[model samples]
Target chain A: MVLLACGTAMAQLPIYNVGRAPTEAELHPSDGVVGSDGKELPPGRGTAKEGETIYAAKCAACHGKNGEGIYPWPRLVGGIGTLNTPIPVQTVGSYSPYATTIWDYIQRAMPPFPLEKNLTPDNIYALTALLLYWNGIIKEIDVMDKNSLPEVQMPNRHGFYPDPPQSTPNKDGTWQPYWNQAKPAAK
Target chain B: MNSKMSDRRGFLKGTAAMAGLAVGAIPFANGNALASVTPGEPNTSMGVTKLGVTPDEPNIQDLLYGGRSRYETTVRIPSVGWNGATGLRNLTPLQDSIGVITPSSYHYLVQHDMHITNIDPRQHTLMIYGMVDRPLVFTMEELKRLPSVSRIHFLECTGNSGLMHYKSMLHDQKLGRADLTVIQAMHGRVSTSEWTGVPLSLLLKGAGVQKQASWLVAEGADLCRHAKSFPLAKAMDDVIVAYGQNGEALRREQGYPLRLVVPGWQGVNNVKYVKRIKLVDKPYYLGRETSSYTNLKPNGKASWYESQVGPKSLITYPSDAHHLPERGLYEISGLAWSGRGAISRVEVSTDGGRTWKDAQLQQPVFRKAFTRFRLGWNWSGAETVIMSRCTNEYGDIQPTMLELAKLWGDQVTPHYTGEEIEHWWETAAIMEFLNNPILPWRVKPDGSVQDALYNTLYNTNGPSKNSYYSGGKI
Candidate 1:
């Protein structure tokens, strides 16, 4: 595909000059996704103690006072060793592999819609800290910010493994069964 | 061309002649079948007919947009939790569906913890940046001006039929009864569509993707900014930044102005209302991938990036909630597809898995799209099981429940010990994700068809000692 595109010569090809460079302001908000590396973490600081107050006012109605999770909302604490259990709870503390994920998820999607835009960077940090504290991963007074959030190692950090490579199709395009392949190994 | 037109005219003339015969048979001057019928009178042996007139012609307003007939009532079912915090999942009515194409309005939808984003096409722009030489942004109009391609494909939630797996497993152990849920409730998370869009490879080439970039994180514009990472190879293969569905503008619930069509992958990877595509060196490990879509195993390890769905098939007709109606010759029909490639063959088994026969595959089978299959079955009114299994071009045959359980490290036996039963239950719960086991439908003597888990001994052994039958008898 690349050779065909290059062979045609981009200028002579049917490539229309429709797209343009985005301005710095336009790119700022779209680039807010905080990866596992936490490179995009914004400058903000908050502690679990401060997050408690914010949780009561904003998140308690849906997430419950202690983050045990209301009817449909998910629980943010407990379920640390339930991955291998029959009834795995799969809460934020047990299953989430990265601390930055808590910050990323709560910052982007927490408290449901219509009110999701209300949280600031500090609020998200505090909420992330409070969830960690409730899960017994962090102290309530420990401040959570750009530098410390990445350092907070989750219990299930090493729990996941990348999926095994799927079997390739044969020369005639018939594929070997996926189940016959070896099981996925931990990375 | 002339011959084709004449053939069409002859077909129309034949249809008109048939209509004339029907009109002559009915005793009505205006050729209105229901005109002479009276309410509460059983004129026809079928049932009492109500006096009704043929509706008047529709006005311009009604003609502006076509609508389904009033008699047609199939609709998508939405799973809205107590607080709507668990996200909205609208399941298409697969039981009532016909053919491969899912109506745009009836397409299955999954809005991750967010409502349908009302995006104005004129204002929406898709940004491509990061690990690229040029960070380019294209407006809706600009995207439409680029080279485009349309393809028919199927999009299925990875969690489709997941809940049914849990329920069926639990019910088998506790009740020894087949699952009572309908096919729509179990397998409605999948739907097929004809998607039209600009290839992501074209857009990435336009932005000059860097050599080191192996993955790209596609993010949506919804409140959650739902994102997932995809291999650059798949992006170059067939990923489409779709702007149109089913020959028309996408429905609002289906990511209206724009969405990613990552063919053959799980639905979540096809980010909806897509706005950004950021090239990266490795997977971004987004929250959706890490915390949600990851599949847990019996060994306490979770598998991530398991995106493609294996080959699977379902018998839509003669499935649960359907009646055999005297049980003579019934056409058993269903749909089959695979994420790897086109379905090569589909087999139907009437007496459980003891015997199988090749089902006729409908013409015009598109790769990575639903393929309709049919077979004629002679139901003897006695209790029996019917099911369909499919093999894709990649030669992946849909596994039975026992075969899947064994793959998941749980062995199925004719008789289960106390400890064995507990182990089986745990495996079933953990194996909920990516469940594509063959589901058998039991046709009872009463003509009622019910969902039967293929692995369970519910059919041969009868209701076990722990049966949940309320009457204390089977």
Candidate 2:
């Protein structure tokens, strides 16, 4: 009987069309994501030196003086070649696959509290440069903008592989793990 | 590989048997001592000599405003610590809980902001914006008027058991350790609740989602403004814009007036105090997704794993913290759940993972909800290790620590440098972050059931280290 009800429910094409349409202005800043290819980066630029000062004032306390990080907090530098070790300390340069993610994260949630010290676009760019420089990925004086940040190559760039697909329970049907199936041979 | 109980005991004695060992640590008598005990009856009674004076206390139950007996104390949320001032985490007492549904007040708390956002229900509004035909805003009352749905689901942190593997590898031999039981340390981070809300799909459909939109950023109104991006696919599937929890308005700590209930996903994705959802074409690479919850691979790459609670199970009764005074007919019970689908089977093993028996699952085992399971065990009073493993209907069997290490250890390593991967394979922390492995409680010859890690306090820093949070204010 329940299956019959579900079958009937599935027969329907659409349900309640509830909310109203949104305008482009309402979605402006928070809507888009900056891709790894630097597609959606907002206009901004900053140098590692400026970011060094910002780091001392805002980030160093929780992230550690050299981005080595304190416990339960998180390290921003070092931990290179340590992933497979017993004490793998995942840091920015050593573990992150993309450099843009650093800028993206800092812009959204650095300090992570009070929600007061909202960083500007330039500050986010500068911190990204400083973090990359500290990790030996870039020179200290290098200025970062949308283009340069995207161009900055990370060591772990080629490291990430797709997750192993596993099945998920869904109402319509069982969702298969996308990564788990055998790939077809190329023609 | 080194599977003998005697071998582990000798190792624990050598390493952790300090001078001031606790007395009565071992139980007396074996399986033979319980031979005379009846299956359903016990002959022991307290010798209170007030038999005829009971009527003088309170006759005919005339008292008003009945209260719970003093002896019936509910489980407390064990405080771990504070993340600065605004963030705090408290683990639910999974060891003391019974049945599948965790009481509303007993639910585990994980907050990025310590200051609970208190919103006036009259003024609060939920805004749906971005790539939609019609951007819409709904008040709390307006949302309630929409078709509401209620469902029970489990919400678990991505790093729920992040310390189990690390604790396990502290020593070579695994002894029954009270401090390292999965229930006391890890399982407490997850809880199930019956959430009531309007389906996000209906809201999105009402807004007429644009063809190009692929992501939705759900933002909270908390001080931290913690936000995460969800796949458009998932947001339109089972996501709920929830306002009620356990049949009542949500608690202040649980987003008060509004939150998103993304069933079967990591707890973080279900943003609390949800005020706005902005649709987009790509993932926002938000702070939580990029820096906090993403997995670090051995090759040094990071991958995002936000959704789907994996298949896992743990025995709560006869667990590491609790004591078994006598060895007799004992009914062992625990919870099993999967993010993939309904749990198909649960198998219990009495001799480590060598032998297995099917356990009975309680009714109404809904997908993505907790399923209570039980099995009766007749202990022979011999030294043994008991554990359980769950299999979801999708044929996803819960992996043991060894199997998980072999599979995902490479992904967790910083770089595939020669020896670190091999070392990671040998350690226990590799599998600690996800679904914790089936924990084993060793039934000692003294008839006491204890965690396999009981004696090794020196190696794992004891049970206090079980808390992932520390009590520090920002």
Candidate 3:
């Protein structure tokens, strides 16, 4: 239901139209959120074999020689089944539920701050493919693009559960937790 | 007439003598009284320099832009190492904090990529689109022209005390040392501010939001384009597209031109430098929500999208690293807050939770904003532990460390019995996002106050493993 400005009183609220309608040129095609459906993925293609060289030159300094990770920086490979262990190593292979997230994270934020915008769409695709191959999810020759990246299923896809519903504060200055409320449908 | 004249002369002589004593206490460095003096010099008897002693004054150029007195030296320090890649997480000095409102300069900061984007307000615009009849683009001036409201609230990082928990737990198991202070070390990732902006509900209403919209994704204008998804219910409730903070344009470190003020929510969802808001039917499940911020449970399952901080309180004045000089009468003060609502009550304990007394809560406590509390105590200059716990209007009381460990199924110590595990199973279903636990401080006989948990783990439980203190220092 749309939350109306007027409550049950049905009073006419003043509409001070301050902002103007955005033009077609002002609206970008992508909102920058690449969901699990991969609807927002841009056009790009790369193979793991081509990504190895790019990974060695650009990513290996911080992610380590084979993605074992330098101290403090994140590891991008292995630890596929370590989520259930006492020391759950939450690498990309072990924790991420969607493959599109790998591309989304690389495109938005990677290789630290000063050089974040240096990577192109093709460079990001190659890095994502390299990390996936290092994690043994894809073969070295497998190609990754906007289409196939979302099709690749991650091992921990079914691991996460929705959080409990938030409590609503009442007029009496007390709150009631929505513990009995049903969880939202999974995306 | 002669007696009156003599009395006036005597009073003038007494005033001259008092002036001489004041001059003797702080010797001037040179003929110019405004010059700063170096201590321990030959002429300086008390080793102190007094300002405003003479009629000849310094220029007002220093007053053009106000600054704190040179005597005040408290500052925010980076929580992590000097490396820039880790995204310098500067922490506020909670020990020195005076009240609920944190100064914008002293506010805690966490830049994901350690890049502070310099945004020009005149050129910056906020775009609201997706599932709306009219997709609106609002310039900063246009937003300011709309009806605006100012609300005081807090923004806290989800990983605020995660490190403290790990270190304290490690110390519990006799693995590592845990020497920490209240500043930057224990509780510093949270800060309160009075944000001025138009209510997001008004913006969404102006756009005529569609019925199918269940969530809205807010994105920042940083180099990384940080983003997070919020439920539409929350967006329409109390969210504010804030432009002003603490009665002025935001500081550059605090997203300068624009940001989202999601009241009472986790700090990550309060996207800074916010530029875009897109309404959607389902959650975007962005990289932050997926790869990070998800709470990994001990049962091999991780809970996602958990927001809202629980009730928590911290004693600031007599906290860790503070020294009481021949303790007599002292007023213990601290801050308490909750995401659910305003703090209804706060109780302080001087004997390590054995006895408690109701603390006086400062009036006009707003919902979800920091509330200051104070209590009076007389210390006999002996060893004892002091702590505080608070309850919110929602009746949610802050838990103890052992209670929290039981809730998370965390083996705090090796002595967990079967009965304890059975009891934990009964209460495991409780929502456990906010890691609020009672933090105690131990007052030593030598008048030094230390973190009680750290002292118990390192000094009492076993021999000290390592003496290395791992936290940012001012």
lDDT of each: 0.71, 0.64, 0.69
lDDT (C-alpha) at residue B422 in model 1? 34
TM-score of each: 0.81, 0.74, 0.81
Fraction of native Cα contacts reproduced by each candidate: 0.38, 0.21, 0.36
lDDT of 2 at B142: 76
| Residue B24's lDDT in candidate 2 | 26
lDDT tens digits, residues B1-474, model 2?
123332333222222212123322222233111112112222234333232111224424536634432223334333332222225666666766668888777788778745667889897878887787667777788789888999998888776765433333232114433233345455677888999999999888877789999878888777667688877888877999999998889988788899998887778888988888887777665567655576654544545643667677888766754555455667778888887678888888776555678899999798888889899888777888787778887767665543443445532222323344333322222333454445667778786566663233223433234211110000
Give TM-score values for chain A, per-prediction.
Answer: 0.78, 0.73, 0.75
Interface RMSD score of candidate 3: 11.4
- Residue A115 miss distance in model 1 (angstroms): 3.9
DockQ of each: 0.29, 0.16, 0.26
State the displacement of the C-alpha of residue B327, model 3, in Å, after optimal TM-score superposition: 2.7
> Poorest 10 consecutive residues of model 2 chain A by lDDT?
A178-187
- Ten-residue stretch with the least lDDT total in model 3 chain A: A178-187
Give the poorly placed runs of model 2, Cα more than 4 Å off. A1-26, A29-44, A80-87, A115-118, A145-151, A163-187, B1-69, B72-87, B113-115, B163-181, B299-303, B409-432, B453-474
lDDT of 1 by residue, B144-223 (tens): 98889999999998778764333443443365333224575567789999999999999888788899988888988887
Residue lDDT tens for model 3, A1-187: 3455333112212366567666676565443667777877888788887788888878888779888877557777776776665445677777888888888888777766564357777777788888888888988888888889989999988878753323234455322222112121111
The ten-residue window of minimal lDDT in model 2 chain B covers B465-474
